[model samples]
Target: MEIVTGMKKITFGVFLLLLLSSFKLEASNYTFGVRIVGKGKPMILIPGLKGSADTYNDVVAHYKDHYTCYVITLAGFAGQPASAELNHPLKGQRDEIIRYIIEKRLHKPVLVGFSFGGTLAIWIASTRPDLIGALIELDGVPFDAGIEKNHVNMDSIRRDARFRNEKIIDAQADYWQHVDSVRHTKKFREQGFLDMKELVTDTTRINQILDWDDLSDYKASRLMVNEMNSLDLRDSVSKISSPILVLGSWKGWVNFKTKETVAARYQKQYSPADKVTIVFSENGKHFLMYDDFNWMIGEMDKFLKSI
Candidate 1:
């Protein structure tokens, strides 16, 4: 009887191992750096410009036990080799994400995006609402008509593209020099561009940021931004039917007289959405996740639970 019981226990252990191996195999098929961790409901995390799958390390750590996180590192960013097929990165990224979700059989997975990633998330949810269950935008907004309102002419597009190309060249040349200067300095932290204080204090996060900075494809980044500058998505936002939670930053630098003005701006910007909830992080900067982590986690948890 003891020998029979031991054999049964060994068989169960082998079955568990095979199940875990199958899950890993399924996740490995994605071309993008899709790091799947933890367990339970599916959650997709898209990082900001020049960010990698690990960009949401803190957030993933917090929710790993409760959710299976699909952290994606886009082509040409986060040290991943640029895909030649991605001629138009913005649209290409959206399509790739949709394909990934379908291929993986992820049902109603919550989408979380930060910065440029958040903007892409909005595009995905607007265009393919069926693929996502809900969305959380962290310091990202739809296109503003004001940027291209005056530059509708072809000449303006040509000029802007040329200018951006030159800027990209300059950025590539000085990228490492800038990285070295900011790697251990306090000057960058003082500028408040990305809540650098939080970055500098966290060595792992700081190193990850710098690593991506060193390997980033500046030309691709600039090209995507230049193309995006010519498009507006106000109408697209109106078409989205999925529930959305937008957490915007209200730092006083963007010609805002008060926090109320900033809040009003975001509310008006996202008003077209039928089901949207907007919140502002008064004390946080662009990297709100790092600046107000506890608040972000609490809000995200609440939003996820509700959905």
Candidate 2:
């Protein structure tokens, strides 16, 4: 998935205020936190990297009347506490989500994940296919990007991931401040803004996203992504038995691939699954929720009702 980052005032400041205030955080023992709202059928919303529980404010606002929503904010993002004890934070997140479901008696809750959260949801569903209800992902999958795809040696990948993660953790203080320094630049900064423009149309949401990235526990978040990106889950998706709806964004890759090609790529990656529906946004970038809310939510609503 493409990532947009950094800060700029942008347009409509109050809208940003409204979204931030929607979630009331209650930290948990599971290296994550929850902001519960509404009542009835359970729904768990997971945000992307650097995302807070409030990232699902729009979805929560719409669904709170009918569904009991569990908006999750994982550690290392949105100023949530990051755990140092967990060897695998992504798995730590996945396992705890399963435990949270069992402990809370949220039987068959719908799982909605964005970006990295979507990747985690895939991990969660694949691990315990019987746990969650239906699965919905917004521009996220068990995709292994960044590292070369041709490398067949899994051990080498694991070692590389570990080294990169360790380097970040060692400098946990300044990891994200620069990627640290690697991504922190004037042109890079402009590109980040450009990314924001491409990914989301709502300026307030853009501002909110930058704050999330700014306050994010860069090392902790990178550790999780580093580990996640090392494993290719294209085939592993077959293990998930639940029905899935994936809304993908393809506008960013227009320079490199056609819409048909990008859509086909998403289909090919998710082809291992038995019951999966993949849809792409016509003009949206990565943040489909903010960029193409109407079309995105329409597809989501249809899927939710179908199951």
Candidate 3:
């Protein structure tokens, strides 16, 4: 029965093909899991630190009708297993993302990053403007350090508060070891929830955030935070050729803080870019997407559709 044998071989081949496809989408060798949606130009959606794909659920629903959404959950975040390369997890993942873009042949794909993902998106576009079409950042700055530098100078901000007390290698590692060790305890979630409450206004969302944080690899998350603050994209912003739209929020800090003052910060950071627009939410917290959905959507739609 040659015909029957041939069918069996074809079936096995199809199964293997599907297996490989699943593995690829799993981002096994990379630093993120990609879930594709809709049918149009590629639009990558990156969430905040320790955030999962669910973070972009509403945003994806909004954009899917027009753009194909590639929802990426970074490695070691929200239950995704930590990648073997952990020392410089954030930068390492940037390279992986570039590889995915080129390999996937997603020419001039739009990048939408939220919070830390927004920063990562900036890094991606700055790294290769040739591969990106547009960048949409939600509450993600070009660089975030506690210092008030007259300009964007990474060298000057190198030893800020975070690193001032972080020179010792062994001690830092041991500290993170202890930090992650208590992940299963209620104290971990409670503490994380308390800090997140300041950023996320919604009580329900804060609870969800705590869950994601506990599932995320503590060392990896902290390493990413360290990497983000250490690097300055103010100079590299000139490298980006694609259009950028940055939507931020000001949680109304006391004393002489206007929307313009807040918006000026983003303007200063992205000053080197050729095509960029900055907008701020009148009354919203750090998670602009959720806190200021209508205004954010309007800004996003105008900026994106115009491009």
Candidate 4:
């Protein structure tokens, strides 16, 4: 009888341990293709240019122990496919996010954007301020407003347009091919920033959903990029109502006569005021999040906690 009771006790303990482990796993996994571990206000992450949900893998690992994190991969850019046409540009992307929030009933979720994704977050906060509880801008500022300084040479833009009536698969294949080709370049090889050598999935599959002919799709994003290249947001920082956190990279991606010169110019161009707190990672590049992951994660945690 003594040996039987001991056996029963051991079995019960093992079962209890298994039950607890299952509970923990379930708590850590959440819907919306996002994983959350802790209990707090939820945070949504928007990725960078030519980026995907996979890009946030490191960032998510850093923050998972703290907040309920939602990492979103925007349509057309990453591997995510759209049910409808990719006819909408930035504004369309914003609207889709808004609709997601409403449908999911995500309460005052903190919105975080990185690089090009940063512009989209700003658009949402500017247009749908009520949906957001707080905004985190990762090295992204608004475009300078004005026709004179921000005017585009349409002829040059026309000449440079790569997506004119291009099919989605063909465009994506070409884009990735360019990416693969660039990876072998001396400059990129030296940097070690390229994605993996063997891509398990052909990302070109996403291009099938895009509707290049849809002006509604191309208009806003094109305009925004144009204005961004032409104008400096330094003068207009005061206009943004939401609390802004600006981050700048020390290095620039492309070849410049001098990187220091480019960094200094960029820093001076988008310096924020008292209402906005700016953080600079001296070792970072345009993709500051990836360049300075721990610093950014700490900064984000500190900011989110304070808010």
Candidate 5:
């Protein structure tokens, strides 16, 4: 009886150690705070503004067994110290990601972005085409629409900028809450419904916005503005040598009636059978990744497999 009890204790200790080891392995495996899984064609996934890399678990799980998946969380978004500032803008964030890929030596990975993330992916492809193998945009403006043209009005843009700035200071306000309010989190396994109030309390969100301040948006907005002001892709749709797939919500751009319309109208700019393929989902909204993830995943699968 004594021998049997000792053996049982030994087994239990081994089980505990194994469980701890497994947890450590999983945590340590995700180097660079980027969660990577599966095995096949390498694919890099970029999340929307203030989004988490972990949100892609469902989508990544579906394809990880067949494709290597890399989910990136922008520096400030994931509790990392903000090396940049509020006025730094989106271009800084994009360049940071571009440098990360180059430094990591990820070869020709399929570049996928959601919302603002889509904008980043497009910028990378446009600027660093050789680094990207295939481009997949989910519910975002595909090309750079000159900032002036895209904004409702200079007054509105400045007002919005001010509002955003104030929210950055509070960090616990619902600045980004409305973004996820319409999203479907049931399928996405999010931490919660992303209540605007709750979002203000979120440490990750607070730190990112506070650290980056207006820099991320300012830079991105201007880079896009310059692209529109000087180098317009309107005529060079055919020049985008990289394989591209664009996705949008079902209501098209009519639902927003204002700000979001620019996003929808841009789709028509591209020909259906052209190098770029535009797909619409009846159930998705600005946060299409959460609204209709299955549909998005299906399209991603089809696109990745084809190219």
Candidate 6:
């Protein structure tokens, strides 16, 4: 019966190997806070800064029947735990996403990102073009307007990034204080602490925002902004080969004045692309997907089908 015992041991070893593989998969998914739903071709959605995977509920609902949606909320955002090892969280996020795609054996799935997440998506597409089939950027550009206007050299960029990194601790403290005030004090709410115009009218959206506002990790947000403000993606845009769809906002918020100006800026910035499509939303704010849902959905559907 020695031969029978040998076979049993081999089978047990195979079972152990499979168990370890399953644990690794679960750990990776948990670390990235990825929530997958639906079944079909893979579709990855990355939410904006301080935003959660819940932000893409509407989009997932629309495409769930046809696509398996992978909604990612980066670590330390939207109440998720922060990673102590990640000094440059956005870069970490990009690397983790690439790893996830590889581990899951996704076949160049469509990647859709909003705001800061869109910036990450752009970086991923540029750096790892083979990992994605198509890309959709919702109100995200390749270069920082401030850095571009000042014509800052690489040394200055490094200096500015360092300065920002040094100030992160104070910024985090101040942000947490503000968050606490908004959460606890009615006076702070009356002082117009939060901008309501940016939020959609839907109850579900409002509730999601409320939940996010309550639990957002300020430290992660600061790290993301520090990296984002210092990034210059002008050189990387030309490296991307996949189909790109940029949904730009016409209603400018801080510095931008008019729709024509905003449109012109994007036209100039993304003009280097050989396979890029730019769509300007007349009424869309920074959150174009929520602000102009029907139009955005239509465009996304058409783009997905085309790609």
Clash number by candidate, in order = 0, 1, 0, 2, 14, 0
Write the residue-wise lDDT of candidate 6 on 1-307 in tens digits: 1223444644666767778999877875545688899999999999987789988988999999999999998878888787664368778888889988998899999999987888889998998997889999888888756312535576687788878887775565667677677665666443323464453534455556656855776666777788887777877888889999998876634466777777777777777777999998877666776788889989999999997
Which ranges of candidate 6 are over 4 A from the true structure?
Answer: 1-25, 28-30, 146-157, 169-184, 187-207
Candidate 1 deviant stretches above 4 angstroms? 1-31, 144-208, 252-257
Residues 1-307, candidate 5: write the lDDT tens digits.
1223444644666767778999787544322247778998788898766566765767787888877898887654544333343543455666766776787688888888876677667767777877888888876554444422544343555566556554554553354454334332353224333432132434464444333332233233333333222333344444456889888763434335443554446665554314687777766555555556788888887887798
- How far off is model 6, as Cα RMSD? 5.1
Clashing pairs in 1: none
Q: Which ten residues in a row have the lowest lDDT in candidate 1?
A: 143-152
TM-score of each: 0.74, 0.82, 0.85, 0.58, 0.59, 0.83
The RMSD (Cα, Å) of candidate 4 is 10.8
TM-score result, candidate 2: 0.82
Relative to the true structure, candidate 3 has a C-alpha RMSD (angstroms) of: 3.7
Taken over the whole model, the C-alpha lDDT of each candidate is 0.73, 0.80, 0.80, 0.55, 0.60, 0.78
Which sequence of candidate numbers ranks them by TM-score, best first? 3, 6, 2, 1, 5, 4
lDDT of 3 at 35: 85
Q: Candidate 2: which stretches are off by over 4 Å?
A: 1-27, 146-156, 171-191
Residue range with the least summed lDDT across 10 consecutive positions in model 6: 1-10
Comparing 1 with 2 on lDDT, the higher-scoring candidate is 2
Off-target runs (Cα >4 Å) in candidate 3 are 1-26, 146-177, 252-257
lDDT for model 5 comes to 0.60
Alpha-carbon RMSD to native, per candidate: 6.3, 10.9, 3.7, 10.8, 10.5, 5.1
